[model samples]
Target chain A: MRGKHIKTVMVGGIFLCATPIMAAEGKLLATAGLSQLEGSGGGGLVPWATLAGYDSRDETTALLFMTDVNITDYRLSSIGVATSFYDRVELSYAQQTFGLPVGLVKQLSVGEIKQNVIGAKVRLYGDVVYSTYPQLSIGLQHKQLDDDSVATALGAKDDSGTDFYVAATKVHLGAVAGYNLVWNVTARATKANEMGLLGYGGPDNNGYQMMMEVSVGLLLSPNWVVGMEYRQKPNNLSSVKEDDWTDLFVSYMPNKNINFTAAYADLGTVATQKDQKGVYLSMTGYLW
Target chain B: MVNHLKTALLMMSVLLVACATPTKTPISLYEEIGGQPTIEAITDNFIDEISFNKDIYRYFEKTNITRFREKFIEHLCVDTGGPCTYTGDTMLKVHQGQKITETDFNLTVDLLVNAMKKAGLTYVQQNRVLKVLAPMRGEMLYK
Candidate 1:
């Protein structure tokens, strides 16, 4: 149909305008250095939200797992899994469980708020890491608010939604003094409506939401990494206007089996809250 | 605050781990490989094999693997913190043409390992070398 053709064309335009081919490839950062990049344990897991996985472009079968803990009185945690195959395609799944028991903390408890996401990433141009070229990738994530009742009971107008993001990643810091830079933007059409009840309305003309993040990864060692990410999501609806977050984390991987991470985060300016900072600790283990 | 504390802990832990665990680079890799001469010999054979390989021969037909081999050594050196700089073409650039599959490249890798063995490398050394080379799957197998 023309509709389908138009949609494909639009998507292709986004890829063409936004990035050039690049090669952002490398091994999974071991635990100690990886935790900071994705807010998870190390090589395989990409912290709280974004999922990079264990293998770079050169890795054929990549298996990874990661998790994250938010610092506010509310306990927000996340876990992710990812795999890359055929050198051009990647698959990932993540579950974010929030408002649960703060096994580590004592006060300010929140109920169980769970969100699940399954994503697919495709490489379109260039390659990172050892390649002189850049590798560009686009991905889509179908997310479900697993416990709609929980989100609704907690006051969300719509409980579940799907989000799609296309990103271009570049990986070659080793040539430039061991520093890696990445820039990405994702426009998401979500059903959760207005930051999930934090704001006012549901999905709007703005199409619900968007996230933009830039990460600079440093190679402390080949299997070790430390990086900082500036992540931002727009407030599209009427409820609780969302804020932005900046974090610095270190990722360390001991081997294929284990990884660890620790981070310092600044939950920056919001509609109401001032600068709030916190700490994160997480670990990941893999079968691969 | 807590993040910095954790970093400090990790740094301290890395030192301890670094001391106790030693680097994972595997000492036997260099030894089992029969050191410098053996690696050089295997490197030559690997170049020869790939130059005639039907699949990826186009990528290296015009290029020499001598610098590539030296660069490989330097990559190992830098990764393991030895005194060297890996200033060679990236894996992606070096293997940019002719379409290599995992099977094709892996077979080549195995052949190189076999060559090393024939040249008198130990199993431990072969595995150790493979460990360092295994991460190259990203760009080398582009179909």
Candidate 2:
């Protein structure tokens, strides 16, 4: 069933990519970062406040993105769509599938974990570029795990929950040796375990915990960016110790309507699995 | 590591000596952006862009293009620390009856950025010029 859903989403993505192309209007090129895993505008792993796409207050911008991750013992894929309105408000939705190794699937009596996420973000103050102040935004994500039987067996307390975060992003043009620099800091209050794939909360801790995430990117040119991100997670589940996640990524925007990103991610451990390092690839298409 | 440290110390001493030598003159923003010729070229491109942009051209319809261009060039030249005098009207005075919206102001800025790009200014130079101009948005908008 999960495989079928993944295939359907992939087909939908391809269809969207084939839609009639229109020139992206407003703001300069590459000001809006690529969509992150959770469908927010950001780097691969961390969310930034800048809206996706270059459209400003006069226009609306839409984006479709698909990401695939190959880990040592597992595979994860996410398909998402996001829209930015007037460069001030954003709405996004994403579906994620976590595939376990065949041996682990048999041992745990679980085939795969599927999750759906809906997110909304509002720009509160400042501008990401062309201003000295750091742009601030507040975002909320509602996650629901489709298969909670494995999560319950692993001592998860809930199958669904909401995560709230406040993010600040600032861009410094020509800050470092003629290269632009972008800095982001986010604080999240979440109860999700492993981004809610294993479910929300647990036996050890059922309350929401605050987490910190930071990311920095250097613009190698107007079209290329290299960055690193660190996201801290809570160890709420006693059954499995959760560690922080980090990634180093490079993104290239060849034009206004398309961009590609590749990254090396260290997801730490999941369940009993250790050293879950992996490679990630994502492609994004923009529509105006 | 030791070689790196020695290199760092040597560079620090060289910088210190350079700083102690007081005869070096500070370059103004105007000089850094080239002189009258570069500023004039940028102004011409900016005017061309504004004229072509339907969103902003309507605002300039009743005004004198040639005179406005000269005033704008003079304004930029003086604002960038050049040896030119700006005898134009104050920002608030000139834009008082226009009642420009934020969107209009931002559109103008975008056009200006494009003009700078067309004038062959680097991103750093463009940003430096924008820093001096962005603050005027408050005076130019909603009045």
Candidate 3:
């Protein structure tokens, strides 16, 4: 019962993809100062997906970096950066760390579940300077799992692998209000045993699995942004497993050098469990 | 060798013809623009376009438009070789911390062209204005 409920929540997790906000809907949302937190094939947080907003810059090329944290019993964190060339083409990279503090992740523990992701993105349409077409981009993410010690500890085959995803993004222009949307589909080698940790779950055959995500954001002011995201993952990998989370967040940018964010997240449990909820406060710094 | 000599004579004849031609009176594009009167006429149109506009300098009103109009014409005429003197300070000195953005600048460009139209300037005359002011982009932007 708990596993099914968690699975249901996964669909909503798509909107909770990336919550880096501040100015997401405006003449500026499409043309923010830096894309460190925004600008993708889809909204922020969709791995290897494209976005609606093109790289809209007119002066010396632009660069941006952002980091978000989820505060709860199970620690999770995400960091990202995006840079544009000639205001048309763009490139980005990100890393996500889940199950932080490892609880008891002794380097000796075999088959310990840890997920690290690296990604790149490119913008292919809509001129950053003057164009009527909605800006578009494409992306790819490489998800890697370290399973050496964990393999021996579990007496099973190593559970490390990768996941691929594609996405699209769009921005709506208006006289009073602005909005942005991003969506994507993820493909994986197998279901059940992928990025989740067994150290956290008692006896679930959780393995590398496939999933999908969709994220969106709205700008309330020139300097403030609010957003929500939800993700769906495979939960049938084992007898004891749960999936899905919903995230609501807000971000503020005082200048080109810094962005501050706060968020509320819902992390479902693995075995006969309850919804694990928490808040995260994080600060991001940009170099160059 | 005879053919080569004939070719050299032909080339020299063309060169001599080109050099002997007298230089026509060079007309200063600024003077052809009708000097201060031309700038003043365009300034009036730009003021109407910008003063009534809500995007840039929306805070200024009809009276403010007249005052700014007078100042701008004086400035443009002086800068473009018209017989006018401008006492205004530097552009950066005037717009410091005004929060002026590129959107506002583009809109101003639209208004300027609209004003020139009202002043009966032809496309060539309009381009003459831009050819001078466009190069000042570095001085007018960023701050």
Candidate 4:
């Protein structure tokens, strides 16, 4: 009886393995891009119009990413998962831990700041390569702080807020000395301060502010790319000056399943720490 | 009379040489890629690649491989400014009822790239070919 039961279980497992597997490999390698800091698909600091996965019009794709930024005074760790459907829409969730320097933590009695971001993006029009016009997308990131004590003591108005943005991206084939050139422009409206790590709004400003972000990249080959990004920021706190962010990055995609990116990020200033710069390292794994 | 005939023949030969001089234009992309042989090689490689892919192969299940091979070569040649004519049907007409999706279209492009790679095309050469042919995507997709 024992032998018969084992035999039947093995046969059932074999039948289950015969089902088709859906692999979302319709898009080209590296075109989907690395995950942004907020768990959206983009560069290190700014979100672009491209979705997070390689899904095409008839496919669906999902991905997971982890990004770490270590600056002169602080460190941030982020991990997230995102999925795209039919190359049309994307949804993402992320958690971030912002670690304070030991000295600052000792003074403020706070060790870290934690936040969660839920994001959604929709492709509005056109494709990056095939269409005559640039690809356009609109997205939103909703953020909530795990503990509001730090933000409340810092004179922030809210512990939760949302950011809205519209992005346009394009890829020009053989445009730069026979290599592909990609560029994106995004306009965002937000009330988040320091991307919601310091909370939303403050004594200086309680209304949504508009900011601009830009990124340009050169595809050295099919699998390698280098780029730079600049993101303008809003100054909401009067106690500490917030600064804009910039980074220069290199990304490599060995295959469709994985991507690795490293960047020198110049965050300028964060929470009163001046001249904050660091290395940003990230990796993404695609699940079809 | 023999001398006169010889002078006439020499003058006629000079006139023929003068007529052919203006037709010597720069080499075209077809010649740059080694012309018909390379085109045929790419097409052969493409057919082999299609036969191995189940998704793309289904689109060609009813297609006549022999005719496709000939027409594809001619299309590549003409599109590359070669000394040939494309006698095949229009791209839209040929793909009328297929209703190809964007994913499959891109997949087909990937196969073609693989075929070009197998035929030993350099990256730049491959890009050049794609640049010329990429604009036809509007005609092939969703129709």
Candidate 5:
């Protein structure tokens, strides 16, 4: 069934690409942000206010992305599709696969975990560059795990959860020694543990908590960007400690059709493992 | 001999002062990007770009190319702090009946950027020009 769904989506993407109502690629280069881990438009670890495509108010655009993170003792891979409508609203779907360490898989009798995330965002006000004020947006991500046995064994209160966030982003042309500078700040409320890979709230905590995230980037040129992002994680699971996430990334956009990003990520500790750090790589292709 | 040396030093200092005074007046964006010739070239290139783009060309089908050329040059000159006045209609008035969509407006901007690039404007220079004109986007979109 999942394979059928993916095939249908790809066919639809190709059909949209051939339609006359497709987006005009109206916005400036690099203005539309890359997909975040949860499939929202943003940096590697933080969601920004910008949408996922460069469409203007009169057009619609769709894109697909794949991301991989190989950290110490674990690996994660995500695939997603996103679309923006008239630059006012964005919707996305993503599936994440988390590979467990050999020892843990043998001990717990589970090799990997899969989760699905559905996201929606609405732009509230302003443009990132043209307006006097920063662009603001509100969004949510609903996550569900494929299986709950591991979560149940780990004392998780739930296998599903939702995260609500508000983000503000801005771009200042020629602000830094004639180079464009972009920044974003986001506040999210959630009860997820390890972004819901290990599951939602634990016995110690069962309520949603607010966390903050930030991203800053400098456009070295119209095609190249260097940036840093920080994401604050919720400590809902008492059995294990959750640490914040940080990354230094470089993105290269040779054209509007595609972009590639590579990052050095520090994910901190997860499930009693200390200092989980690794490289994260992602690619996005614009279909329209 | 002493008097000659003093007079020579005095002349050298006077010349230095004269050159320093003009340097104190910062170069305007217009002059920094090559004055009238570059502006004219950008206008011509912009017109060519519009003519080639079918979507953008529709908006200018009824426009008078000559008047647009003259007025656009003047408008850019004034926006860049050059010595010129805009004799053309206000942006709002000009675009009121057009009902321009955001996509079309931004597409126009992209054409303008291409024009600037062809006219030998540096990336920094192009950004500076965009910064000055970006604030006026509201007047041009969705009239």
Candidate 6:
């Protein structure tokens, strides 16, 4: 009976967490970047050093996000939530679904791939807006794939693994004709192929490889941002050639609690699909 | 070869002329923010806003508004590279016994941002001033 009650409470908690609640009123405007695809506070494709939400040093902020990407040959969808405490540390969770064509699915013996990502980030030093030094953060993501059989067929050695990264972000006020510019650089160590949709640690090499990611944003106004991102990936699977990803995006905040983003993404190639380019859209709601 | 030589000579002359031309020095933050009169007006408006704010108003209950206004204007002017000197106490010295918290500090900044907006300061100008003031949070809070 006790176990049944606990299970019921857990199910209720998931539903309650999806609703947006009113947050504290004192956070600075647009200090937090938009939610990345993996649920971190960042651009569309890459994570930045900024924490999620507008909460200042003394408050806590919560964020919920949903995103969809439609490429020429595939579709990716994600839903996640994140929280930042005292503007110092962040915790996030996301569930991703990758869908492919029926022919490709048959070839790979899989219809779709599903993943769950648990992420944590800690601010180390500096302020992106008010300091001369760039804000620096260290983050980790532990990803678990749902289907181990498909991963095994693709020469994957592990179904779950952790990615470690360090990111630096800086905001330059009045950088170009009085507009603010935000720049970020991140170094990641990971063994995940295509962010673990194809699983981790291929047969050729079951070791982590270092990769670089970069994002730059221009503040067109206090509530609008235009940005671009580039992310380099490692070639873990010899059968498939992995290429870099790039995107151009625009984000708008209607108020402190709501934000929307749209982008054009060039994923290069995934699996056997070539020139896998498409549209990406995301919406996020903030709570305190 | 002769045409290439002529192009090279023309390019060299243009480069030399560009190098010889005098460049104008950029204006300082004080002048860019409209100098003394504008700053004084902003300070007065900011003081009014702060005086009405419930969060930090208790700290200013016994203060002198006129002197505080003058000191604030002077402080901002000197901080922004204007030809003025601040005669008030340092941030740490003044807030040493105030027992200010981070919430108090943030509220004060919020009021200041609102006042700057009300006074018609552009976003860039307001951020420039806020950047200079933001670092003072360390010295003024809980000290």
- For model 3, what is the C-alpha lDDT against the true structure? 0.46
RMSD of 6: 8.3
Q: Which window of ten consecutive residues has the lowest lDDT sum in model 6 chain A? A: A1-10
lDDT by residue for model 6 (A212-244), tens: 887877787778988777788878887776777
**Greater-TM-score candidate between 4 and 6:** 4
Candidate 6's DockQ is 0.17
Residue pairs in steric clash, candidate 5?
none
On the 0 to 100 scale, the lDDT of residue A68 in model 1 is: 51
User: Tens digits of per-residue lDDT for model 2 on A119-194?
Assistant: 8999898878766689899999899999898788778899999999999998765555435677788899999999
Model 3 chain B lowest lDDT segment of ten: B1-10
lDDT of 2 by residue, B1-143 (tens): 23323433454355345434543328766887787888888889998998898989999999898898899889999878899999999999999989886567767887888888888788767766876776676678779
Docking tier of model 5: it is: incorrect
iRMSD of all candidate structures: 10.5, 8.2, 25.5, 21.5, 17.2, 10.7
Per-model DockQ: 0.06, 0.17, 0.01, 0.15, 0.21, 0.17
TM-score value, chain A, candidate 5: 0.92
Query: Could you tell me how far off, in angstroms, the CA of residue A136 lies in candidate 6 after the best superposition?
Result: 2.0
Identify the CAPRI category of the predicted complex in candidate 2.
Answer: incorrect
What C-alpha lDDT do the candidate models reach, one value each?
0.49, 0.80, 0.46, 0.84, 0.85, 0.79
Error of 1 at A155 (Å): 6.7
Task: Indicate the residue-level lDDT of A186 in model 4.
Answer: 89
Q: Which portions of model 1 miss their true places by more than 4 Å?
A: A1-66, A100-110, A149-157, A176-206, A269-276, B1-143
The global Cα lDDT (0 to 1) of model 4 is 0.84
Candidate 2 displacement at residue A202 in angstroms: 1.5
Clashes within 3 Å, all models in order: 54, 0, 40, 0, 0, 0
Off by over 4 Å in 4: A1-22, B1-28
Reference-based lDDT, residue A230, model 6? 77
Q: What stretches of model 5 exceed 4 Å from their correct place?
A: A1-24, B1-25
Residue B3 error for model 6, in Å?
36
